[model samples]
Target: MGLKSVLSKVFAARVNRELNYLRKNAIALQQKTFTDLVDAAKDTAFGKAHNFAQINNYQDFKANVPVHDYEDLRPYIDRVVKGEENVLWPGKPKYLAKTSGTTSGVKYIPISKESMPQHIKAARNALLSYIHETGNADFVDGKMIFLQGSPVLAEKNGVSTGRLSGIVAHHVPAYLQKNRLPSYATNCIEDWEQKVDAIVEETHNQDMRLISGIPPWCQMYFDRLSAKAGGKKIKDIFPNFKLYVHGGVNYEPYRTRMEDSIGFGIDSIETYPASEGFIAFQDSQKEKGLLLLVDSGIFYEFIPSEEYFNEKPTRINLKDVELEKNYALIMNTSAGLWGYSLGDTIKFISKDPYKIVVTGRIKHYISAFGEHVIGEEVEHALMSVAKQEGIDVVEFTVAPQVNPPAGQLPYHEWFVEFGTPPANLQAFAIKVDKALQTKNIYYFDLIEGNILQPLIIQSLQKDAFINYMRSEGKLGGQNKVPRLANDRKIADGLKGYIS
Candidate 1:
């Protein structure tokens, strides 16, 4: 036990108390957040245009302001981007988190001074919660690394702009500065492969204890480290490493392979973070879902995922959310986004203290033949079979194969990269198909009716996904292959890598 670890335990206790209060008063906290957001922005251009001054409650707000995706809100965002003050919020935004989207192309999400602290605090508290629950804080004294985009920023209209991960790198607490790895110069490398190589050189022999990033990038780092150390596992290179904090993608599919790469199991914390806000974090090792952050500077709304594409979807507040139902997430944040559609879908597993699991992306799914399979379902089905058969799946993606050969019926196609090839590939496919059929009834019905064939697995060569992403110029940072796509864009791109 070092001095830092001792002090962290005491600090963790205090933070836990504050989190408990937030959990206990979840609904009240959300209501207060909603009221504060509306009141603070009442005089802004958007507020005035939306009748925010006359709104008294959720219903009034919903009636006055319609849910908006990026395109719908582009006019106000454009004004803000042109350096206009008080266009969306009371003042100019502190930063713009730039991201790429399918329809909108480039998006600049605001990060107001009022909302930025919530992002930092939510991430900090997630670690503190882990320390409070597990009583293992010694890792605080060792080196930490967050495999992310370059911390470099570009300025537009005097506002700093970059990838959300890169923007967050600027706010890391000063106390952890000395313990953080890959020196500032290394992190600034523009290319990801070069960056990882630089990171491996800097941290392979350091006293690393905590690692954070999305799973795929972290896996890439592990592979680089293993090669640098001549096939030594991650645990051997960094014996002190204890916790892995991951977000932006589900960790389940990569868990087995990642653990094997490390040669042992380690604790992990899942988080729900987006450019717009930090919504939740895994609060307990024993719990299944990430605990929702009601006290954060955001108000949440949900619409049943099935109805998301409808002209007028039914929106429900936090208090009305039901368990196990998929809903498209909506947000009204202190950053000045009002009724903004977040594009992600989530399912509540517990309502007493408000815990949710990221289900899938609203736009990422297979519905060509009306099967409508989601990210969560396909992941669960494949991982379930993988676990049972001791298979080491590196990466995978699903797409609807709408037009196959002349005689073959249209079906879902799965492209998978396997570390250890299965003995019987066709038999393995049948098992995965059965597992998916159990998870999605529509797919089963389609198969039974001869409307579609069983999903075909396209075994991919080593680094197939990496090659595909690299070819598309999305090789690193926050870019990830979608788990499911309605079109053949990704499936067609992956054809060259088929084993």
Candidate 2:
């Protein structure tokens, strides 16, 4: 290995060692003073001008400071955009991570310099955890491919205006950096069309080992790669690939399709990445749930999902959190967000303090048809059916659609793609329908003709859904197919291939 590789290995080793030390001493670390956390947060842009006095102190801060949704912080975000340093924390934010809000349109989330360490540490811990679980740290020594957004810094009026990814790319260790294939292979730097072309070209003949990114985009890239390789399997192209790191959205639907397209059984490592912060990561084994990076320059809170939706929403601190209960995740990050609800739901899988599973998005549910189907429930039902009926469903999307006749009640339509045809496709569909009915009571009622028709299964052609996403200009980067659609609009839009 070269000097850079040697240095990176050393750095990675040190980071791994530190993470193990922290994990071994997690209980003691959890006892860290809230005052110190608040003080550190104050030093960043988020806490600078905010009245810590209003909340009194750390104890009162926890008691009185209500959990805030993106809407509640809109004014603060606006203030930051207007050059108000106090609202965003103190120093000028380096960049704004542009993200889509559920009700709100586009949001530009501020990221500070101090928050960079947290992101890096959390990501590193995730990597180390994956290594510990899978015994595959050796892959890190090889060239890893990050299927991410463009690293090209944008230029407005001839000056460099970089996004967060571009800024972070510069800080990646030179050894790891060298191993990275040219940006053209994975980055959407130029216009969308041009970026796709670049990605196709750059990934042409690389010995990529570890692939990481959103599922939809990664799948699309593989589709293109598969086409270019003239129907050759993914193993034929990237023979060195060992793992697939995915985050940004749920991976259940795309998991089967990915393995089918890639022609291998590489492990899938899920991540809990948000514009606000890199919150958690899947251990390498891909069996245990994600591990939260608690001490990574952020203070966390968990409001019970019911309380979050109640008339008088109540919040809970880390100390009050219980295992296996669903909660709306909130965080006070080094990035300056205070009591910010991430708009995601998670359930503790283990009491080691940080092991949890991303259950679902708070707003991503299908209650329109009275099914009360959330992402996790749907994923579980789908996985169960797939296992019982022996179907290898790669990717899927479920939406409530008005089918058969206009006045008829809506039904859940599932678009699925399989790797190998099950012995009984009809029986598989029946099992899935039954699974949905049993697991989700609302779905059961709907199937009983109280609200809707039985679930309809659509088996898509190989790589068909991926092409559809690419055609919509949402192929790569952070975009992924929505698992559950509550309205008929998105459902109807996907109607052409109901076979």
Candidate 3:
């Protein structure tokens, strides 16, 4: 083998060895907590995992730890908010990560001292892997710009409490942190509107080499920057930018638009970050999927997607999990989320259990009119139609609206917002219908002489939907227009423009 191949093999072997050692250690360390909880639940007979009383072995553990959603943890969260110890873990949490969902309002998620290391470790490993994969460790000889939240701590009752991103930024390595870039603390901390101009001004002549954040916000920043620079590209603003890192949701929809807005083909990496913890990250290659930080401060359980919707869900241990299978993630973290379900679905793409791809959100499924449609199916259908019709969508959300008709099944009404609208809207819609029908037989059956009709396209004015979201007090942050809604509530909310 050549020297490069041999070196690659050596590095892979080291990573594998470290992963194995960590996994083995974690099993023993984590079991202490798991066993104690199992005993306590058995004793209480009313706790969440009380059903696991019958479990004598790992099989019992799998069967008994009932699958739970965020709603199920409301009481625990309340306790945490009230400063209760051991709500999910053993001590007072260091901070609370703020997150929200379609059903849940702003959630204050607890993060313990132990879990902080895991988050940091996962982020570091991902960065190192990226460096190794791209052989670009030296690319950031210049300042690294983190397009993140502000470092200004929120004041409550005259005391300083910080946002999650602020706290994380405070801990970033001093050497790696940008000295020239705008302070997220001063510039991007307040209302997004106030932050946008500062972001534009700060980045105008900076030597930013790395940019990281959610895609939509990054897009907005670049758009504003381009406009301020008299239509100059992102490369013109920061001529040395070498890498872009983004997470929270899929970046596929905004990838092309972002590239165009930036006017350069920089390396891109995606991360799977959550309020609970930094779970996984795309390695350097960006093609091998994300590596799960198994040794980091979290213990993971995988529930097969097939069994996800079942009333009683079964969880598989990481030691025995397989690749290419859809699994609902269960996390037991130092942050105190034992057997807690994060409501995300992922599939392993590599033999290493760490390498995974986030498929979709578990609650983001639609079954209106008895035709069950999932995120993967919808994304696939959209991509297929885009390829067939030569349309490029900047972003889109699908909601199943019921149109009940006499002697007919209910059909889906798609609300699509495209960057490149097709010349023949009807043809594009028909192509989408065909794509869905081909992928899902149920969709085909629903369409054949039934109530379901062709997919409808509503080409929105550029930034129209974004403006709407901003008006709703939901823009400029982690919030993106949700992809799929089970019912017509969100869809109806977006009416008037649906043509």
On lDDT, the leading prediction is 1
Best by TM-score: 1
How high a TM-score does candidate 1 get? 0.99
Residue-wise lDDT of candidate 3 within 1-499, one digit each (tens)? Answer: 3343345445555564665564456456445545654554353322443454565665666555555566787777677767665556565677776666667887777766766666666665565566655666544466566666667665432223455666676667665564436765554456886787777776677777778888888888888888888998888888778788889878776777788778867788888877677877876464668766655566678888778878776667666678877888898666666578898888888743357888887778776655666677788888777866667776777776566566645556677777788888878877777887887677777788575765666666677667778778877766777678787766776675654
List model 2 lDDT by residue over 1-499, tens digit each: 4454345455666766777666566545544634555665554344544556454455678655567888888888777666665564655566677655558977767777777766766766666655554445566666777766666664332223454555556567554776775563346464544565576687778778888777777776787788888998888898878888888777776677788888977777788777688877775473578767666666777878756777666666665678888888888766667778888889988766458888887777787765668788888888887766667776777877655576666677777767666676677777777877777786787678657766777777776666667667665566667777776654565566545
Sort all candidates by TM-score, best to worst: 1, 2, 3
- Candidate RMSDs in Å, in order, are 0.8, 3.6, 4.9
Worst 10 residues of 3 by lDDT: 40-49
lDDT at position 111, candidate 2: 73
Between candidates 1 and 2, the one scoring higher on TM-score is 1
**Ordered list by lDDT, greatest first:** 1, 2, 3
Model 2: residues >4 Å from true position, as ranges? 1-13, 24-33, 40-50, 54-59, 131-141, 154-164, 184-188, 191-194, 284-287, 369-371, 401-410, 417-427, 445-452, 458-464, 467-472
Report the poorest 10 consecutive residues by lDDT, candidate 2. Answer: 154-163
Model 3 stretches astray by more than 4 angstroms: 1-57, 60-64, 154-162, 178-180, 184-188, 404-409, 449-451
